[model samples]
Target: MTKDTRKTEYGNESISSLKGADRVRLRPGVIFGSDGLDGCQHSFFEILSNSIDEAREGHGNVIEVTRFTDHSIMVQDWGRGLPVDYNTKEERYNWELVYCELYAGGKYQNNSGENYEYSLGLNGLGACATQYSSEYFDVTVFRDGYKYRLHFEKGENIGGLSKEKCKYEQTSTIQKWKPDIQVFTDISIPLEYFQTVLKKQAVVNAGLRFILKDEESGETFVYCYENGIVDYIKEITREDGFTEIQFYETSTKGRDREDKPEYKVKMQIAFCFNNHTNLLEYYHNSSFLEYGGAPDKAVKNALVYEIDKCIKNRGKYNKDEAKITFADIEDSLILVVNSFSTVTSYENQTKKSITNRFIQEAMTDFLKQQLEIYFIENKIESDKIVEQILVNKRSRETAEKTRINIKKKLSGSVDISNRVKKFVDCRTKDLLKREIYI
Candidate 1:
């Protein structure tokens, strides 16, 4: 065999590392999970999450989001402005850390409640990652009775941090950035995404006001839920639910394992049985849990157990009937769960779900106890809930049976004697001669 001319030398120089902005700009998918519109949308969420965390800490009550005609997005919060000055311990300017460095943030020590007890921007990568992925980013912070400003382009700081004295009453932080088209294939985030996200934040945060301004459409909208998920449920059911809404909330401390450090978790649940509408939403640390790993499992287990027990005790089930499933309860149930924990185990950077064993156990036990007490205190409401769930279960079973029978009949060999109406059979086996009629 001839010597291989194509064989290239493999040496230490072959290994390389991405630094600073290149880490996110070169591989946007690695950080944001996509290089498409989804990633672009997530970048927007990162900035909004920071604002939400600040507001949750009682630093602010209102957050304003603006979508300019040029597609640049701005998030303004009336909170204690971000720290951008020099850090004595880190020996670096916070502006550089927050706007340029990845994995440098204030939330890393959240478990100790040093900065925040519960927060949405737990990864410490949102601010920097978004900045790196943006074409141009600008930050204006009002704190310490002064104004601080920073600007960046393509992940590189410009003119450094600017400080000036200003007569401002409330401390605030305003960020404006345009998602880079080079980094993200598409950055045209729709207006509906902002509306939906702001609404969700308002629902989970309670009493927090979100103002959305759309420059393209010249429209402004506000979203706030004074009673959080409970008010949201009322809005969805419109007083037409078969049973009255029930709200339960509790706080507890626990750990995933014996050796793990203990942490606090706060859980809120609001639900009602409605024949005409149904919804199930789970949120952890103000981030919407689309997959709902822990909370979903807990909700399913507790609701099914309590409802099934109620059915058996009330003689609502037929003899030898199968137990009720979560689907049965879910069919007529409209529930919203908002939970917060000092330590959260997000499955990934996208934060669509959480997998905290302690949170799951705490929620399941609390929900079971609250449901048991509710059933005992409100007999009529519990009866209505049980009856509706049974009706849904029966309806679903009947539908499944009908579907199976139809599928079986359709799968059978074609018989001219029992031909379907208006369906004519072709006489020839030739491919070109076969025809179908409507």
Candidate 2:
């Protein structure tokens, strides 16, 4: 349907008609992506991603994702399990809503939301889509001193959940389940994909250790990045050899004169340079907002201002023709950005890319002020970086001229650059396609 075709204002008739399971189909595209194997993997992403969020919350430090020969995928997390409550008045477990209903999660309403305040689950259909998309699905949660199981097939419920002996201690629940073959069109579960995803999560999330054990295949893989995004910076920049892996980390908590203690921010920036051409850069949290957002606008201005002062002080650039490019600043440069908060949305993961501040100008300001201090104090590194920046400037100028010449040859004016939105980039934007492409 064209964007103009759908009614702008629809009634809630279908909304109520949608049984919890049926609700999943009206927007199955919203959950599964394109009704393909990749979408099946996304079903796994939702569960596994939630576990990763648990790790981010400091409730636990391990995540386990296992794929069996039957193409049945099971993610066992060492983190806290889902809430399994026996509604005394209702006489049934709330797992039905937790698993099959949309917007029925602890993350909703921010009640006891100390952990998942920044959760992607707040998107609200985590288990809702899991059940509708799977032919056979079972959720085993160990929480609040109980082990509970909720089973489903296709989109229909089979009845009430059964309480079982908890395998996990009161602290953490052990789990294992099979995503039925009928619903998951893809029969092949690649070990590399699992490894890569888990590794990325380990590096991005930092201290968590995720383990994978396939009983049928009798294979096991473990991933835990002690250094977190710092190691991730190394992995990406390994292509280039960086000199001096200087790192600094500091966390701030409590009210910022706003009298709200829950507002917390953790920052980590690591700077290094390598031999390769590209400045390998990775950012988590709000630092990435500088990628052309309001925050980026602020930071770009501040960065240029700060660097210009430094250059003038050092008396490095006497020519007005010289220019400073982010690329130049990043030449052979490796920078890592890490931020955390109790209230934030990472676009789709627990990465915390956006904050309640809405306008991330403050994040940019924080980065610029702190980095300026860092560059000033570490002049040896600053000099090295400045030299690298000059080289980058020369290269960028050359590339710009080359591009302009190429464009001029083709047409008087050419599209400077083309960028696709995150939604469009993913094969299926129907489901939450906000995933790490790499």
Candidate 3:
């Protein structure tokens, strides 16, 4: 074909769209919700999630995070080093292909027989996106007496992969990166944010040791939780007036049909009610569900249902007064719900919310069964909860009466001004003061 014919194309002034690395560079917000400090922080979480996944799979017991004086972050894990064998299809090392290419990871399997049955990272764009969003990214892997290293500058490879004889005995993977200044103008991660995330990860992956170190200050914080979410709840509500936290966990198995593959669900729930409100944290496969979608609603429904059942059995209220409003239930409650399934679905690429119907159903059923059993087994603790509920109901009633009385007294005392009703006096151009009375 002639040179002129080789480049023929027709469109109404069409332009080529960015691809892969370019797209990620231009649209970091698309991958990480924000291209600011929050997104920079999330990039670290995305990289850290891989190490946490290894811990979840029972391959690794320690994950360490370090913040350097130069504002670079490093995450190291003692898992089997990332696959480094040559790939004929990609004509490159597997580790190189996995990082340089977008949507090229092992967590995309949707079938039951897949290796990643319950994964913390849902999307295929895991570390690759983080690499693209970083100004300098390096990956070092040590495995089977071989050490491999790769480096990239602003998503472009600096050189070919290098391999050498490993000096370390244990297999490990270390990833260190500095965020791109052009993308996130200010990429400083808050120390408290790192602590909160690392602590939560340690709580989720019970036996895993999560370490956070400050290279400048030479200070380190180590988090390891044997009891996981149960301990997390206890620590968060330590200062509040609360009953002993109730904990429940169950695993169930079933298949959609006889011909279909079997699926398993494991759920853990720990909750405590106190006199002060606290945020509820939920995790599906170790990913935080910030939006609290369907599964959160299901858990809340189950709590109200079980609590109401306890009240009715004790004859605390008649049929009309039996209903427990959400306000009453939510006023001072702290809860943590974790669900893991062989097959899970998130609402979006960010994985901020989980949206599987089966998860909702399974969690609701699990909570109701376990909570009822708990109430039956611990009658003394159950009675304390019941008393708290009654107290909440009385307080709500008294507050409502006081509000109405105050409103009535105010209305009876204040002179009704036509300007206030029409909002006319407030619209005036005031030189010194303008007050409208109703």
Candidate 4:
């Protein structure tokens, strides 16, 4: 096979063999699910996820994504970069293969540990897929106290894993990729989506700093949260659980993995009830797992059972106004449950779901016991929390009923907007002409 004139690697493969046009032309919709804001959003998210992985490993926090006028993009992270080591025999590439080949990555291999105990990029397709979809790709890695660089042009690595011997008196290397305009279709990424991505990342992972700069627009947004979930709780509930629980934190093993060489569970849970009717539960990891799972469910159940038992046995218990369900307490109470386990994977290579169901169950039981003790010991403070939960339960119920009523009222309406008739009769007919709301 004839190699492309660019820096060719030792592989007996040709870029022409990959069928770039044939693969993308017929199935363009696959890489980018749709041709709209969603597809545009995915373009940036794919890169952001890479940065988030670095944050997960405690390697680096600050990630910068810059935009260009012609739609080229650059994403740089100060985290531990993609590893590179020649396969002593194949004389091929290491990290370079990761960029070009399908399902080749440390995250999915189950070989990495520590913060990477779980892999976010499941199927190991994240790198290869993104590279395949883009016009070309470039990667600069700073690892093992050395800096190396590789460039892939048109879904082919021009040169495989070229170490920059003369460059980088600094440790960080640069990665620049020009996205395939044919797939993206005349779009510069929206700033709002980028902000949302960075904000979510900062909230889930503490001490992570992300910066997004639009080179042409001369705009840069920075997100960094040092206090982690505590700050996140404060942002949502406007109440700090720690201010009342003070020096108390209850923890349990949230995930167990014998295969992992070393494993640990660091979980801190605190919650305070407020007068608001809504329930807000914040369960997060360094950069992923916002959705609650068995672990979080287990924890909530324990708290509810403990409160109920306390009220039943002891007559002077708090929450006499309303019987609080675990559901009830979740509302109006700001709960921050964070677990950083030395072992990441509960079971799957994706590491999105936790496998150890018993961990959540164990935590639930432990928290229930301790919550009972804390309540008995601190009557005034604990009772205040109890009363707050009752208030939330009542309000949450009312809110749900109100929503049902509203939906019923709008049953016959064609538009869900508040002013259906007025909206329909607006001066010039132009939802089509309406400014880009989407």
Model 1 lDDT, full chain set: 0.93
Q: Between which residue pairs do clashes occur in model 4?
A: 7-158, 117-344, 279-331
Which sections of candidate 1 miss by over 4 Å? 1-7, 415-438
Ranking by TM-score: 1, 3, 2, 4
Candidate RMSDs in Å, in order, are 5.3, 13.2, 6.9, 12.3
- In candidate 2, list every pair of residues with a backbone clash: 30-431, 241-274, 290-296
Worst 10 residues of 1 by lDDT: 416-425
Q: For residues 1-438, could you state the per-residue lDDT of candidate 4 as single tens digits?
A: 997788757565654543543354234455556555456556556666767766676667677887777767788887656667686654756765566666556664333452365334445555666666577778877766666877776676675666654444334435677767666664566667678768867866778888888776798888887876667556665643422523234444433445534334556665555555344443334434445565667766887787666666655344545566777666555565666554444333223346455556666766776787888888877767656655667788789899998988777564545544334434556677655233
Clash count, one per candidate: 0, 3, 0, 3
How much does candidate 1 score in TM-score?
A: 0.92
List the candidates ranked by lDDT, beginning with the highest. Answer: 1, 3, 2, 4
Candidate of highest lDDT? 1
Q: What lDDT tens digits, residue by residue, belong to model 2 across residues 1-438?
A: 557665656666545555656555454545666455566666666777667667667787877777777777777776767766666654656776666666665675442454474344566676667767666777777776677777677777686777766555545543334544555556365777777667766766777888977666698888877887667667766656545666766665543336644555555656567757444333443223323333344445555667767777898885776657565665565665555555554444323234344335455666678768867888887787777777778878889899999978777453333333433334665667566653
> Which residues of candidate 3, in runs, are more than 4 Å off?
1-11, 89-92, 110-113, 239-242, 254-262, 276-279, 318-322, 411-414, 418-438
Model 4 lDDT, residue 161, Cα = 66
Q: Candidate 3: minimum summed lDDT over ten consecutive residues — where?
A: 416-425
In angstroms, give how far residue 51 of model 4 lies from its true place. Answer: 3.6
Candidate 2, superposed: residue stretches over 4 Å from native: 1-18, 32-34, 88-92, 109-120, 143-146, 165-189, 214-218, 235-243, 250-262, 277-305, 345-359, 402-438
Tens digit of per-residue lDDT, candidate 1, span 111-224: 898998899998789999999999999999999988999999999999998999998989999999999999999999999999999999999999999999999999999999
Q: Which TM-score value belongs to model 3?
A: 0.87
Residue lDDT tens for model 3, 197-253: 888788788888998999878899999998899888888888784677888888887
